[model samples]
Target: MGWIYLILAGCFEVVGVTGMNKVIKNKNVQAYMILFTGFIFSFGFLSLAMRTLPLGLSYAVWTGIGTVGGTIVGMLYYGDSKDWRRILFIAMIVIAVMGLKLTSS
Candidate 1:
């Protein structure tokens, strides 16, 4: 389904972003490969979902997923900040994404 593709796209987006961080931190060629592959799959899945989903709604959901996922990844692996404010904002984004999905026909 379109939603499935969209979700997968978001997951891959996180992978790609994490890969980019890895590449920068360690200059690993394998990380670069992951970056390339993850992005390619991310966009590919996003495009597939766009065939049926509304553009604005789909994009917002995709970016919301990527933003939240990337933030969590940063906190978990890269030692990024993890405060109440950050958690609250991430929750808001998740709520917005859920709202979009629920409101869409």
Candidate 2:
């Protein structure tokens, strides 16, 4: 259940970041609303996840997942950079996040 919450939080983080880009592009009220809503839901799920997971492990995973997810979304949807070097760095972050979970448990 906690894992589920963490995953949901990560997904929401991605959604919030994507919505933010949309809001920036069009500068519409609806986009801002969606972005704000996504942020609220993301934090809600993240808080739920903290109940079971260690603080450092949960935070590392949450932030790492969010970073990677947001970068991918930006690259695909917003025409952001997709260079190999950047992708490699993101992969490292994912590995580190996994290591934190494995060792913290």
Candidate 3:
């Protein structure tokens, strides 16, 4: 279940990133709640994942997921750049995350 927790942590990290974007655009209690709650859950799950996963492997995968997730969120909801180069880099990150998962025991 360590992998599950790690994936959840990564997802929550994206939620936190979204909250950050919201807070930047509009400061309010709801946004603040989302921001703090997302990070709290993210860190909690990450710690749980560390119990079974190697530190380096876990951190790399977590950040990879977050980076990909956040970038996609930006592209989808925030109207960030959708250039081919940006998509190519996102795909690379996904491939790297998959490779790490495959290599890990």
Considering every candidate listed, which one attains the maximal lDDT? 1
User: Over the stretch 29-74, how does candidate 3's per-residue lDDT look in tens digits?
Assistant: 9998899988899999999999999999999998998999999999
lDDT-based ranking: 1, 3, 2
- Ten consecutive residues with minimal summed lDDT in candidate 1? 20-29
- For each candidate, the alpha-carbon lDDT, in order, equals 0.96, 0.87, 0.95
* Model 2 clashing residue pairs (backbone): none
RMSD of each: 0.6, 1.2, 0.6
Overall local distance difference test of candidate 3: 0.95
What is the lDDT for 89 in model 2?
A: 98
- How much lDDT does candidate 2 score? 0.87
Quote the positional error of residue 30 for candidate 3 in Å: 0.5
What C-alpha lDDT, on a 0 to 100 scale, does residue 14 get in candidate 3?
Answer: 94
Residue 5 lDDT (model 2)? 95
Tens digit of per-residue lDDT, candidate 1, span 1-105? 999999999999999998999899888889999899989999999999999999999899999999999999999988999999999999999999999999999
- Residue 37, model 3, lDDT: 89
Clash totals for all candidate models:
0, 0, 0
Which residue pairs in candidate 3 collide? none
